[model samples]
Target: MISTPPPDWNSYVQSGIHQPNLPTIQEINKAEFAPNVIRLGTGELSPHLFPRERMKQIFHRLANLIDSLGYEEPKGLLFLREQLSKYLKTIGIEASSSTILIVSGALQALQLISISLLQRGSTIFLEKPSYLYSLHVFQSAGMRLFGLPLDENGVQTKMITKQKKRQNASLLYTIPSFHNPTGILMSEERRRELIDVCEQERLI
Candidate 1:
Protein backbone atom coordinates (compact mmCIF):
# COMPACT_ATOMS: atom_id res chain seq x y z
CA MET A 1 0.00 0.00 0.00
CA ILE A 2 2.03 2.93 -1.33
CA SER A 3 1.81 5.97 -3.56
CA THR A 4 3.89 8.77 -5.03
CA PRO A 5 5.35 11.29 -2.61
CA PRO A 6 4.63 15.02 -2.62
CA PRO A 7 6.81 17.19 -4.90
CA ASP A 8 8.49 18.75 -1.84
CA TRP A 9 10.44 15.56 -1.20
CA ASN A 10 13.61 14.80 -3.20
CA SER A 11 13.67 12.20 -5.99
CA TYR A 12 15.62 9.72 -3.85
CA VAL A 13 12.79 9.66 -1.32
CA GLN A 14 10.02 9.77 -3.90
CA SER A 15 11.50 6.91 -5.89
CA GLY A 16 11.24 4.62 -2.84
CA ILE A 17 7.78 5.74 -1.81
CA HIS A 18 6.07 3.22 0.47
CA GLN A 19 3.42 3.51 3.15
CA PRO A 20 5.15 3.87 6.50
CA ASN A 21 3.71 2.48 9.74
CA LEU A 22 4.75 0.71 12.94
CA PRO A 23 2.87 -2.59 13.01
CA THR A 24 3.48 -3.13 16.70
CA ILE A 25 2.39 0.41 17.47
CA GLN A 26 -0.75 -0.08 15.41
CA GLU A 27 -1.50 -3.28 17.29
CA ILE A 28 -0.94 -1.51 20.61
CA ASN A 29 -3.40 1.14 19.57
CA LYS A 30 -5.94 -1.52 18.61
CA ALA A 31 -5.69 -3.61 21.82
CA GLU A 32 -4.47 -3.51 25.38
CA PHE A 33 -2.05 -6.36 25.83
CA ALA A 34 0.13 -5.68 28.86
CA PRO A 35 0.28 -3.39 31.88
CA ASN A 36 4.05 -3.00 31.56
CA VAL A 37 5.03 -3.35 27.93
CA ILE A 38 8.83 -3.43 27.88
CA ARG A 39 10.11 -1.39 24.94
CA LEU A 40 13.44 -2.86 23.84
CA GLY A 41 12.94 -1.16 20.50
CA THR A 42 14.65 2.23 20.86
CA GLY A 43 16.94 4.14 23.20
CA GLU A 44 14.64 6.28 25.31
CA LEU A 45 14.96 8.19 28.54
CA SER A 46 12.53 7.39 31.33
CA PRO A 47 9.90 10.05 32.06
CA HIS A 48 10.47 9.48 35.81
CA LEU A 49 14.06 10.71 35.44
CA PHE A 50 13.07 14.18 34.20
CA PRO A 51 13.57 17.18 36.50
CA ARG A 52 10.12 18.74 36.14
CA GLU A 53 10.88 21.94 38.09
CA ARG A 54 14.06 22.59 36.08
CA MET A 55 12.23 22.00 32.77
CA LYS A 56 9.35 24.25 33.90
CA GLN A 57 11.73 27.18 34.49
CA ILE A 58 13.53 26.51 31.19
CA PHE A 59 10.23 26.54 29.25
CA HIS A 60 9.09 29.64 31.16
CA ARG A 61 12.18 31.51 29.96
CA LEU A 62 11.70 30.18 26.41
CA ALA A 63 8.06 31.39 26.36
CA ASN A 64 9.28 34.96 27.02
CA LEU A 65 11.30 35.05 23.77
CA ILE A 66 9.74 37.27 21.03
CA ASP A 67 10.17 34.70 18.24
CA SER A 68 9.24 31.68 20.35
CA LEU A 69 5.82 31.27 18.69
CA GLY A 70 7.19 31.67 15.18
CA TYR A 71 8.76 28.97 13.01
CA GLU A 72 12.38 28.42 14.01
CA GLU A 73 15.31 28.61 11.59
CA PRO A 74 15.88 25.39 9.62
CA LYS A 75 19.24 24.90 11.37
CA GLY A 76 17.51 25.41 14.73
CA LEU A 77 17.74 28.14 17.41
CA LEU A 78 21.22 29.67 17.18
CA PHE A 79 21.54 30.31 20.93
CA LEU A 80 20.77 26.66 21.76
CA ARG A 81 23.22 25.47 19.08
CA GLU A 82 25.90 27.86 20.43
CA GLN A 83 25.43 26.45 23.92
CA LEU A 84 25.49 22.86 22.55
CA SER A 85 28.64 23.67 20.56
CA LYS A 86 30.37 24.87 23.75
CA TYR A 87 29.29 21.73 25.64
CA LEU A 88 30.48 19.42 22.82
CA LYS A 89 33.83 21.26 22.70
CA THR A 90 34.31 20.62 26.43
CA ILE A 91 33.89 16.89 25.61
CA GLY A 92 36.53 17.13 22.79
CA ILE A 93 34.08 17.50 19.89
CA GLU A 94 35.22 20.56 17.93
CA ALA A 95 32.09 22.01 16.32
CA SER A 96 30.45 25.38 15.81
CA SER A 97 26.86 26.60 16.07
CA SER A 98 26.76 27.20 12.30
CA THR A 99 27.85 23.61 11.69
CA ILE A 100 25.16 22.12 13.95
CA LEU A 101 21.98 21.36 12.05
CA ILE A 102 19.42 20.29 14.63
CA VAL A 103 16.49 17.91 14.27
CA SER A 104 13.63 17.18 16.71
CA GLY A 105 14.97 13.77 17.72
CA ALA A 106 17.09 10.76 16.66
CA LEU A 107 14.20 9.33 14.58
CA GLN A 108 13.78 12.64 12.75
CA ALA A 109 17.53 12.80 12.13
CA LEU A 110 17.52 9.23 10.72
CA GLN A 111 14.53 9.93 8.48
CA LEU A 112 16.09 13.17 7.27
CA ILE A 113 19.32 11.37 6.44
CA SER A 114 17.33 8.73 4.57
CA ILE A 115 15.42 11.32 2.50
CA SER A 116 18.19 13.80 1.91
CA LEU A 117 21.43 11.84 1.92
CA LEU A 118 20.63 8.19 1.13
CA GLN A 119 19.75 7.00 -2.37
CA ARG A 120 17.71 3.95 -3.34
CA GLY A 121 19.73 0.66 -3.38
CA SER A 122 22.64 2.32 -1.52
CA THR A 123 24.16 0.15 1.20
CA ILE A 124 24.48 1.18 4.88
CA PHE A 125 26.88 -0.65 7.17
CA LEU A 126 25.94 -0.91 10.82
CA GLU A 127 26.31 -3.16 13.89
CA LYS A 128 24.87 -6.66 14.03
CA PRO A 129 21.57 -6.79 16.00
CA SER A 130 21.62 -3.00 16.42
CA TYR A 131 18.47 -0.97 17.06
CA LEU A 132 18.96 0.35 13.52
CA TYR A 133 18.14 -3.14 12.28
CA SER A 134 14.76 -2.89 14.01
CA LEU A 135 13.93 0.39 12.28
CA HIS A 136 12.11 0.56 8.92
CA VAL A 137 13.24 4.04 7.94
CA PHE A 138 16.25 2.87 5.91
CA GLN A 139 14.34 -0.07 4.39
CA SER A 140 11.50 2.26 3.40
CA ALA A 141 14.03 4.46 1.66
CA GLY A 142 14.96 1.43 -0.54
CA MET A 143 18.46 1.32 0.98
CA ARG A 144 20.17 -2.01 1.66
CA LEU A 145 21.47 -2.49 5.22
CA PHE A 146 24.29 -4.81 6.28
CA GLY A 147 25.28 -5.57 9.86
CA LEU A 148 28.88 -6.23 10.85
CA PRO A 149 29.90 -8.42 13.76
CA LEU A 150 30.71 -6.84 17.13
CA ASP A 151 33.07 -7.78 19.94
CA GLU A 152 33.54 -6.69 23.58
CA ASN A 153 35.17 -3.52 22.28
CA GLY A 154 32.92 -2.70 19.30
CA VAL A 155 32.44 -3.51 15.63
CA GLN A 156 35.15 -5.58 13.98
CA THR A 157 36.80 -3.11 11.65
CA LYS A 158 38.72 -6.05 10.13
CA MET A 159 35.48 -7.16 8.47
CA ILE A 160 35.08 -3.79 6.76
CA THR A 161 37.02 -4.82 3.68
CA LYS A 162 35.07 -8.07 3.26
CA GLN A 163 31.71 -6.33 3.73
CA LYS A 164 32.72 -3.59 1.26
CA LYS A 165 33.47 -6.25 -1.34
CA ARG A 166 30.04 -7.81 -0.73
CA GLN A 167 28.21 -4.50 -1.13
CA ASN A 168 28.82 -0.90 -2.10
CA ALA A 169 28.44 0.69 1.35
CA SER A 170 28.02 4.47 1.19
CA LEU A 171 27.22 5.04 4.86
CA LEU A 172 28.35 3.60 8.19
CA TYR A 173 25.95 4.40 11.02
CA THR A 174 27.11 3.57 14.53
CA ILE A 175 26.24 4.26 18.16
CA PRO A 176 29.80 4.31 19.51
CA SER A 177 29.06 5.77 22.93
CA PHE A 178 26.74 3.82 25.19
CA HIS A 179 25.30 1.88 22.27
CA ASN A 180 21.60 1.12 22.46
CA PRO A 181 20.35 -2.36 23.47
CA THR A 182 23.91 -3.73 24.13
CA GLY A 183 25.04 -0.60 26.10
CA ILE A 184 28.61 -1.23 24.96
CA LEU A 185 30.95 1.70 24.33
CA MET A 186 33.62 1.58 21.63
CA SER A 187 37.20 1.86 22.87
CA GLU A 188 39.23 4.93 21.92
CA GLU A 189 41.69 2.90 19.79
CA ARG A 190 38.87 1.12 17.99
CA ARG A 191 37.11 4.43 17.44
CA ARG A 192 40.23 5.92 15.87
CA GLU A 193 40.75 2.92 13.57
CA LEU A 194 37.07 2.93 12.56
CA ILE A 195 37.27 6.62 11.72
CA ASP A 196 40.46 6.09 9.73
CA VAL A 197 38.86 3.23 7.78
CA CYS A 198 35.71 5.24 7.05
CA GLU A 199 37.83 8.16 5.86
CA GLN A 200 39.85 5.87 3.64
CA GLU A 201 36.69 4.33 2.19
CA ARG A 202 35.08 7.76 1.63
CA LEU A 203 32.04 6.69 3.65
CA ILE A 204 29.71 9.16 5.27
Candidate 2:
Protein backbone atom coordinates (compact mmCIF):
# COMPACT_ATOMS: atom_id res chain seq x y z
CA MET A 1 0.00 0.00 0.00
CA ILE A 2 1.19 3.53 -0.79
CA SER A 3 2.24 5.53 2.24
CA THR A 4 -0.06 8.43 3.05
CA PRO A 5 1.56 11.77 3.86
CA PRO A 6 1.35 12.75 7.53
CA PRO A 7 -2.02 14.48 7.95
CA ASP A 8 -1.64 18.15 7.07
CA TRP A 9 -3.07 19.14 10.45
CA ASN A 10 -1.47 22.55 10.91
CA SER A 11 -3.34 23.86 7.89
CA TYR A 12 -6.59 23.44 9.78
CA VAL A 13 -5.67 25.38 12.95
CA GLN A 14 -7.30 28.81 13.03
CA SER A 15 -4.61 31.52 12.80
CA GLY A 16 -4.51 33.47 16.04
CA ILE A 17 -2.59 36.28 14.34
CA HIS A 18 -4.51 39.27 12.97
CA GLN A 19 -7.40 38.62 15.33
CA PRO A 20 -9.01 41.86 16.50
CA ASN A 21 -9.10 42.73 20.17
CA LEU A 22 -12.45 43.27 21.87
CA PRO A 23 -12.49 45.61 24.87
CA THR A 24 -15.31 45.60 27.40
CA ILE A 25 -17.68 48.55 27.28
CA GLN A 26 -16.64 49.76 30.76
CA GLU A 27 -12.97 49.53 29.84
CA ILE A 28 -13.52 51.52 26.66
CA ASN A 29 -15.59 54.09 28.48
CA LYS A 30 -12.90 54.50 31.17
CA ALA A 31 -10.16 55.29 28.65
CA GLU A 32 -8.62 58.72 29.20
CA PHE A 33 -9.03 59.76 25.57
CA ALA A 34 -12.41 58.12 25.15
CA PRO A 35 -14.45 59.60 22.34
CA ASN A 36 -18.22 59.44 22.03
CA VAL A 37 -18.53 55.78 21.13
CA ILE A 38 -21.75 54.05 20.11
CA ARG A 39 -21.17 50.32 19.87
CA LEU A 40 -22.97 48.56 17.01
CA GLY A 41 -20.33 45.86 16.46
CA THR A 42 -21.69 43.34 18.96
CA GLY A 43 -25.23 41.88 18.96
CA GLU A 44 -25.77 42.12 22.75
CA LEU A 45 -29.09 43.62 23.80
CA SER A 46 -29.18 46.67 26.00
CA PRO A 47 -28.44 45.66 29.59
CA HIS A 48 -31.02 48.13 30.87
CA LEU A 49 -33.75 46.26 29.00
CA PHE A 50 -32.99 42.90 30.61
CA PRO A 51 -35.21 41.83 33.51
CA ARG A 52 -32.40 40.92 35.92
CA GLU A 53 -34.66 40.28 38.95
CA ARG A 54 -36.93 37.96 36.99
CA MET A 55 -33.93 36.12 35.50
CA LYS A 56 -32.39 35.67 38.98
CA GLN A 57 -35.66 34.23 40.26
CA ILE A 58 -35.88 31.83 37.31
CA PHE A 59 -32.27 30.65 37.79
CA HIS A 60 -32.80 30.21 41.53
CA ARG A 61 -35.84 28.02 40.83
CA LEU A 62 -33.87 25.94 38.34
CA ALA A 63 -30.92 25.54 40.73
CA ASN A 64 -33.23 24.25 43.46
CA LEU A 65 -34.42 21.39 41.17
CA ILE A 66 -31.24 19.41 41.99
CA ASP A 67 -28.45 19.44 44.58
CA SER A 68 -25.80 20.05 41.94
CA LEU A 69 -26.12 21.14 38.34
CA GLY A 70 -26.26 18.06 36.09
CA TYR A 71 -24.80 17.78 32.65
CA GLU A 72 -27.48 18.99 30.23
CA GLU A 73 -28.39 16.75 27.33
CA PRO A 74 -26.28 17.27 24.21
CA LYS A 75 -29.39 18.30 22.29
CA GLY A 76 -30.32 20.67 25.16
CA LEU A 77 -32.75 20.65 28.06
CA LEU A 78 -35.87 18.70 27.05
CA PHE A 79 -38.17 21.18 28.78
CA LEU A 80 -36.65 24.08 26.81
CA ARG A 81 -37.07 22.18 23.57
CA GLU A 82 -40.73 21.43 24.38
CA GLN A 83 -41.27 25.09 25.18
CA LEU A 84 -39.69 26.09 21.85
CA SER A 85 -41.89 23.63 19.98
CA LYS A 86 -45.01 25.04 21.62
CA TYR A 87 -43.86 28.59 20.81
CA LEU A 88 -43.21 27.72 17.17
CA LYS A 89 -46.61 26.02 16.87
CA THR A 90 -48.24 29.21 18.18
CA ILE A 91 -46.64 31.05 15.22
CA GLY A 92 -47.99 28.44 12.69
CA ILE A 93 -44.70 26.57 12.19
CA GLU A 94 -45.04 22.84 12.75
CA ALA A 95 -42.13 21.67 14.92
CA SER A 96 -41.48 18.96 17.48
CA SER A 97 -39.00 18.90 20.37
CA SER A 98 -37.51 15.60 19.18
CA THR A 99 -36.87 16.91 15.69
CA ILE A 100 -35.13 20.06 16.89
CA LEU A 101 -31.38 20.21 17.43
CA ILE A 102 -30.74 22.95 19.93
CA VAL A 103 -27.57 24.99 19.39
CA SER A 104 -25.85 27.62 21.52
CA GLY A 105 -26.53 30.30 18.95
CA ALA A 106 -26.91 31.06 15.25
CA LEU A 107 -23.18 30.68 14.56
CA GLN A 108 -23.15 27.21 16.06
CA ALA A 109 -26.28 26.35 14.09
CA LEU A 110 -24.60 27.37 10.81
CA GLN A 111 -21.38 25.59 11.72
CA LEU A 112 -23.20 22.37 12.60
CA ILE A 113 -25.21 22.48 9.38
CA SER A 114 -22.07 23.14 7.34
CA ILE A 115 -20.21 20.21 8.92
CA SER A 116 -23.16 17.88 8.36
CA LEU A 117 -24.13 18.82 4.82
CA LEU A 118 -21.02 20.27 3.13
CA GLN A 119 -17.93 18.54 1.79
CA ARG A 120 -14.57 19.80 0.64
CA GLY A 121 -14.84 21.32 -2.86
CA SER A 122 -18.65 21.44 -2.68
CA THR A 123 -20.13 24.59 -4.21
CA ILE A 124 -22.29 26.86 -1.94
CA PHE A 125 -24.33 29.76 -3.17
CA LEU A 126 -24.44 32.85 -0.95
CA GLU A 127 -25.84 36.34 -1.30
CA LYS A 128 -23.29 38.88 -2.53
CA PRO A 129 -21.87 40.98 0.34
CA SER A 130 -23.39 38.57 2.84
CA TYR A 131 -22.44 38.12 6.51
CA LEU A 132 -18.63 38.04 6.74
CA TYR A 133 -18.59 35.48 9.57
CA SER A 134 -20.76 33.08 7.56
CA LEU A 135 -18.45 33.46 4.55
CA HIS A 136 -15.50 32.66 6.81
CA VAL A 137 -17.29 29.57 8.15
CA PHE A 138 -17.86 28.27 4.60
CA GLN A 139 -14.23 29.01 3.72
CA SER A 140 -13.04 27.07 6.77
CA ALA A 141 -15.17 24.12 5.64
CA GLY A 142 -13.35 24.22 2.26
CA MET A 143 -16.45 25.08 0.24
CA ARG A 144 -16.23 26.70 -3.20
CA LEU A 145 -18.12 29.94 -2.55
CA PHE A 146 -20.32 31.56 -5.19
CA GLY A 147 -22.27 34.80 -4.93
CA LEU A 148 -25.76 35.73 -6.10
CA PRO A 149 -26.18 39.47 -6.55
CA LEU A 150 -28.91 41.41 -4.72
CA ASP A 151 -31.05 44.45 -5.50
CA GLU A 152 -33.57 46.57 -3.57
CA ASN A 153 -35.92 43.57 -3.30
CA GLY A 154 -33.07 41.30 -2.07
CA VAL A 155 -31.02 38.53 -3.77
CA GLN A 156 -31.58 38.71 -7.52
CA THR A 157 -33.02 35.38 -8.63
CA LYS A 158 -31.78 36.11 -12.19
CA MET A 159 -28.19 36.17 -10.93
CA ILE A 160 -28.72 32.78 -9.34
CA THR A 161 -30.01 31.48 -12.69
CA LYS A 162 -26.94 32.84 -14.48
CA GLN A 163 -24.57 31.34 -11.89
CA LYS A 164 -26.35 27.98 -12.10
CA LYS A 165 -25.90 28.09 -15.88
CA ARG A 166 -22.14 28.57 -15.35
CA GLN A 167 -21.65 25.93 -12.64
CA ASN A 168 -23.50 23.36 -10.56
CA ALA A 169 -24.49 24.91 -7.23
CA SER A 170 -25.31 22.67 -4.25
CA LEU A 171 -27.28 24.94 -1.95
CA LEU A 172 -28.67 28.47 -1.93
CA TYR A 173 -27.99 30.15 1.46
CA THR A 174 -30.38 32.98 2.18
CA ILE A 175 -31.68 35.08 5.09
CA PRO A 176 -34.87 36.17 3.19
CA SER A 177 -36.39 38.17 6.04
CA PHE A 178 -34.49 41.05 7.67
CA HIS A 179 -31.30 40.00 5.91
CA ASN A 180 -28.16 40.64 7.95
CA PRO A 181 -26.22 43.88 7.32
CA THR A 182 -28.60 45.08 4.57
CA GLY A 183 -31.88 44.20 6.33
CA ILE A 184 -33.70 43.77 3.03
CA LEU A 185 -36.58 41.33 2.74
CA MET A 186 -37.18 39.05 -0.25
CA SER A 187 -40.36 39.73 -2.24
CA GLU A 188 -43.11 37.08 -2.24
CA GLU A 189 -42.80 36.55 -6.02
CA ARG A 190 -39.05 36.08 -5.71
CA ARG A 191 -39.56 33.69 -2.79
CA ARG A 192 -41.97 31.58 -4.88
CA GLU A 193 -39.57 31.58 -7.82
CA LEU A 194 -36.68 30.63 -5.56
CA ILE A 195 -38.68 27.68 -4.16
CA ASP A 196 -39.48 26.59 -7.73
CA VAL A 197 -35.85 26.89 -8.77
CA CYS A 198 -34.67 24.90 -5.77
CA GLU A 199 -37.22 22.18 -6.57
CA GLN A 200 -36.22 22.16 -10.25
CA GLU A 201 -32.54 22.01 -9.28
CA ARG A 202 -33.26 19.47 -6.54
CA LEU A 203 -31.37 21.51 -3.93
CA ILE A 204 -32.49 21.44 -0.29
Candidate 3:
Protein backbone atom coordinates (compact mmCIF):
# COMPACT_ATOMS: atom_id res chain seq x y z
CA MET A 1 0.00 0.00 0.00
CA ILE A 2 1.13 3.56 -0.66
CA SER A 3 2.03 5.71 2.34
CA THR A 4 1.17 9.34 3.02
CA PRO A 5 3.77 11.85 1.86
CA PRO A 6 6.00 13.20 4.63
CA PRO A 7 6.96 16.41 2.86
CA ASP A 8 5.44 19.88 3.36
CA TRP A 9 4.16 19.09 6.83
CA ASN A 10 5.29 22.49 8.09
CA SER A 11 3.56 24.14 5.19
CA TYR A 12 0.30 23.92 7.15
CA VAL A 13 1.65 26.27 9.81
CA GLN A 14 3.20 28.44 7.13
CA SER A 15 -0.28 28.79 5.69
CA GLY A 16 -1.26 30.59 8.97
CA ILE A 17 -3.17 27.79 10.72
CA HIS A 18 -1.05 28.28 13.84
CA GLN A 19 -3.09 28.25 17.05
CA PRO A 20 -2.81 31.70 18.60
CA ASN A 21 -1.93 31.97 22.28
CA LEU A 22 -3.01 34.55 24.86
CA PRO A 23 0.41 35.84 25.87
CA THR A 24 4.15 35.78 25.21
CA ILE A 25 6.76 33.65 26.98
CA GLN A 26 8.27 36.67 28.70
CA GLU A 27 4.89 37.64 30.15
CA ILE A 28 4.21 34.12 31.38
CA ASN A 29 7.68 33.84 32.92
CA LYS A 30 7.32 37.17 34.72
CA ALA A 31 3.93 36.20 36.14
CA GLU A 32 4.79 32.60 36.98
CA PHE A 33 8.06 33.48 38.73
CA ALA A 34 7.01 36.67 40.51
CA PRO A 35 7.95 37.01 44.16
CA ASN A 36 4.23 37.01 44.99
CA VAL A 37 3.29 33.77 43.33
CA ILE A 38 -0.39 32.89 43.42
CA ARG A 39 -1.31 29.91 41.23
CA LEU A 40 0.50 27.80 38.67
CA GLY A 41 -0.36 27.72 35.00
CA THR A 42 -1.80 24.22 35.58
CA GLY A 43 -2.22 21.71 38.35
CA GLU A 44 0.21 18.79 38.68
CA LEU A 45 0.88 15.90 41.02
CA SER A 46 3.91 15.95 43.31
CA PRO A 47 6.69 13.35 43.08
CA HIS A 48 5.12 11.33 45.88
CA LEU A 49 2.24 10.36 43.62
CA PHE A 50 4.48 8.57 41.09
CA PRO A 51 4.84 4.77 41.45
CA ARG A 52 8.62 4.83 41.60
CA GLU A 53 9.06 1.60 43.50
CA ARG A 54 6.63 -0.24 41.25
CA MET A 55 8.35 1.21 38.18
CA LYS A 56 11.74 0.05 39.48
CA GLN A 57 10.36 -3.45 39.97
CA ILE A 58 8.85 -3.43 36.48
CA PHE A 59 12.18 -2.35 34.93
CA HIS A 60 13.98 -5.10 36.84
CA ARG A 61 11.55 -7.66 35.43
CA LEU A 62 11.87 -6.31 31.87
CA ALA A 63 15.69 -6.36 31.92
CA ASN A 64 15.62 -9.97 30.67
CA LEU A 65 13.58 -8.97 27.58
CA ILE A 66 16.46 -6.94 26.10
CA ASP A 67 17.02 -9.49 23.31
CA SER A 68 13.47 -8.83 22.01
CA LEU A 69 13.89 -5.01 22.13
CA GLY A 70 14.10 -4.62 18.36
CA TYR A 71 11.25 -2.71 16.65
CA GLU A 72 8.04 -4.64 17.23
CA GLU A 73 4.65 -4.69 15.57
CA PRO A 74 2.56 -1.50 15.41
CA LYS A 75 -0.13 -2.83 17.76
CA GLY A 76 2.47 -3.11 20.58
CA LEU A 77 3.13 -6.03 22.92
CA LEU A 78 0.12 -8.29 23.21
CA PHE A 79 0.99 -9.24 26.77
CA LEU A 80 1.09 -5.63 27.90
CA ARG A 81 -2.13 -4.94 26.05
CA GLU A 82 -3.74 -7.97 27.62
CA GLN A 83 -2.70 -6.77 31.07
CA LEU A 84 -4.03 -3.30 30.33
CA SER A 85 -7.25 -4.75 28.98
CA LYS A 86 -7.82 -6.58 32.25
CA TYR A 87 -7.13 -3.38 34.19
CA LEU A 88 -9.55 -1.37 32.07
CA LYS A 89 -12.26 -3.96 32.70
CA THR A 90 -12.53 -2.86 36.33
CA ILE A 91 -13.37 0.64 35.09
CA GLY A 92 -16.37 -0.51 32.97
CA ILE A 93 -14.56 -0.39 29.63
CA GLU A 94 -14.83 -3.84 28.05
CA ALA A 95 -11.79 -3.52 25.84
CA SER A 96 -9.85 -6.38 24.31
CA SER A 97 -6.14 -6.74 23.54
CA SER A 98 -6.91 -6.10 19.88
CA THR A 99 -8.22 -2.60 20.68
CA ILE A 100 -5.19 -1.54 22.66
CA LEU A 101 -2.48 0.32 20.73
CA ILE A 102 0.54 1.48 22.64
CA VAL A 103 2.07 4.60 21.15
CA SER A 104 5.08 6.57 22.36
CA GLY A 105 2.78 9.04 24.09
CA ALA A 106 -0.63 10.66 23.81
CA LEU A 107 0.73 13.25 21.39
CA GLN A 108 2.01 10.62 18.97
CA ALA A 109 -1.31 8.82 19.22
CA LEU A 110 -3.12 12.07 18.42
CA GLN A 111 -0.71 12.70 15.53
CA LEU A 112 -1.34 9.28 14.08
CA ILE A 113 -5.13 9.57 14.43
CA SER A 114 -5.21 13.06 12.98
CA ILE A 115 -3.11 12.10 9.98
CA SER A 116 -5.16 8.99 9.39
CA LEU A 117 -8.69 10.45 9.64
CA LEU A 118 -8.61 14.25 9.53
CA GLN A 119 -8.82 15.84 6.11
CA ARG A 120 -7.58 19.35 5.34
CA GLY A 121 -11.00 20.92 5.87
CA SER A 122 -12.18 18.69 8.69
CA THR A 123 -12.77 19.93 12.24
CA ILE A 124 -12.30 18.43 15.72
CA PHE A 125 -14.10 19.47 18.90
CA LEU A 126 -12.28 19.99 22.16
CA GLU A 127 -13.00 21.89 25.37
CA LYS A 128 -12.69 25.64 25.56
CA PRO A 129 -9.57 26.95 27.31
CA SER A 130 -8.05 23.53 26.66
CA TYR A 131 -4.53 22.14 26.52
CA LEU A 132 -5.10 21.33 22.85
CA TYR A 133 -4.74 25.05 22.09
CA SER A 134 -1.16 24.78 23.28
CA LEU A 135 -0.50 22.03 20.71
CA HIS A 136 -0.20 22.35 16.94
CA VAL A 137 -0.39 18.67 16.07
CA PHE A 138 -4.02 18.74 14.86
CA GLN A 139 -3.55 22.04 13.14
CA SER A 140 -0.32 20.80 11.61
CA ALA A 141 -2.37 18.06 10.00
CA GLY A 142 -4.66 20.75 8.55
CA MET A 143 -7.58 20.18 10.93
CA ARG A 144 -9.84 23.02 12.02
CA LEU A 145 -10.22 23.19 15.80
CA PHE A 146 -13.48 23.83 17.69
CA GLY A 147 -13.73 24.57 21.38
CA LEU A 148 -16.75 23.29 23.32
CA PRO A 149 -17.79 25.35 26.30
CA LEU A 150 -17.37 23.82 29.73
CA ASP A 151 -18.62 24.48 33.23
CA GLU A 152 -17.63 23.49 36.76
CA ASN A 153 -18.97 19.98 36.11
CA GLY A 154 -17.15 19.59 32.75
CA VAL A 155 -17.86 20.01 29.05
CA GLN A 156 -21.32 21.38 28.27
CA THR A 157 -22.85 18.34 26.64
CA LYS A 158 -25.96 20.26 25.64
CA MET A 159 -23.98 22.31 23.15
CA ILE A 160 -22.41 19.36 21.38
CA THR A 161 -25.27 18.83 18.93
CA LYS A 162 -25.38 22.51 18.04
CA GLN A 163 -21.64 22.83 17.49
CA LYS A 164 -21.34 19.51 15.67
CA LYS A 165 -23.79 20.74 13.11
CA ARG A 166 -22.12 24.14 12.85
CA GLN A 167 -18.54 22.88 12.60
CA ASN A 168 -19.08 19.45 11.06
CA ALA A 169 -16.65 17.88 13.49
CA SER A 170 -15.62 14.23 13.12
CA LEU A 171 -13.75 13.88 16.41
CA LEU A 172 -13.83 15.15 19.98
CA TYR A 173 -10.53 15.56 21.81
CA THR A 174 -10.51 15.69 25.58
CA ILE A 175 -8.24 15.36 28.62
CA PRO A 176 -10.72 14.28 31.28
CA SER A 177 -8.36 13.48 34.13
CA PHE A 178 -6.41 16.49 35.35
CA HIS A 179 -7.38 18.52 32.31
CA ASN A 180 -4.35 20.57 31.32
CA PRO A 181 -5.44 24.22 31.38
CA THR A 182 -8.61 23.97 33.47
CA GLY A 183 -8.58 21.11 35.97
CA ILE A 184 -12.35 20.72 36.05
CA LEU A 185 -13.18 17.07 36.69
CA MET A 186 -15.86 15.59 34.47
CA SER A 187 -18.80 14.13 36.35
CA GLU A 188 -19.98 10.56 35.79
CA GLU A 189 -23.33 11.69 34.43
CA ARG A 190 -21.63 14.03 31.99
CA ARG A 191 -19.29 11.28 30.91
CA ARG A 192 -22.23 9.03 30.06
CA GLU A 193 -23.94 11.90 28.34
CA LEU A 194 -20.86 12.54 26.25
CA ILE A 195 -20.74 8.93 25.21
CA ASP A 196 -24.43 8.88 24.36
CA VAL A 197 -24.18 12.05 22.31
CA CYS A 198 -21.12 10.82 20.49
CA GLU A 199 -22.83 7.55 19.72
CA GLN A 200 -25.90 9.35 18.40
CA GLU A 201 -23.77 11.63 16.23
CA ARG A 202 -21.42 8.86 15.11
CA LEU A 203 -18.42 10.86 16.27
CA ILE A 204 -15.08 9.41 17.21
lDDT of each: 0.79, 0.75, 0.79
Which candidate's TM-score is highest? 1
- Give the poorly placed runs of model 3, Cα more than 4 Å off: 1-58, 85-99, 132-134
1-204 in candidate 3: lDDT tens per residue? 999978785666467645544467447756865767754464545456899999999999989877786777789988889999999999999999999999987678888888787777688899987774335788777888888898887888888888788888989988776677777888888899999999998889
By TM-score, rank the candidates, best first.
Answer: 1, 2, 3
How many residue pairs clash per model?
Answer: 0, 0, 0
**TM-score, cand. 2:** 0.71
Error of 1 at 184 (Å): 2.2
The candidate, 1 or 3, that scores higher on TM-score is 1
Distance from true position, residue 104, model 1, in Å?
1.2
Tens-digit per-residue lDDT, 46-137, candidate 2: 66889999999998888867654687879888888999999999999999998878888877787777778877678888888787667766
What does candidate 1's lDDT look like per residue over 89-184, in tens digits? 999999999999988887678878887888778888988867743357788777788999999899889888777867889898888988776888
Off by over 4 Å in 1: 1-34, 38-40, 60-63, 85-99, 132-134
Error of 2 at 98 (Å): 2.5
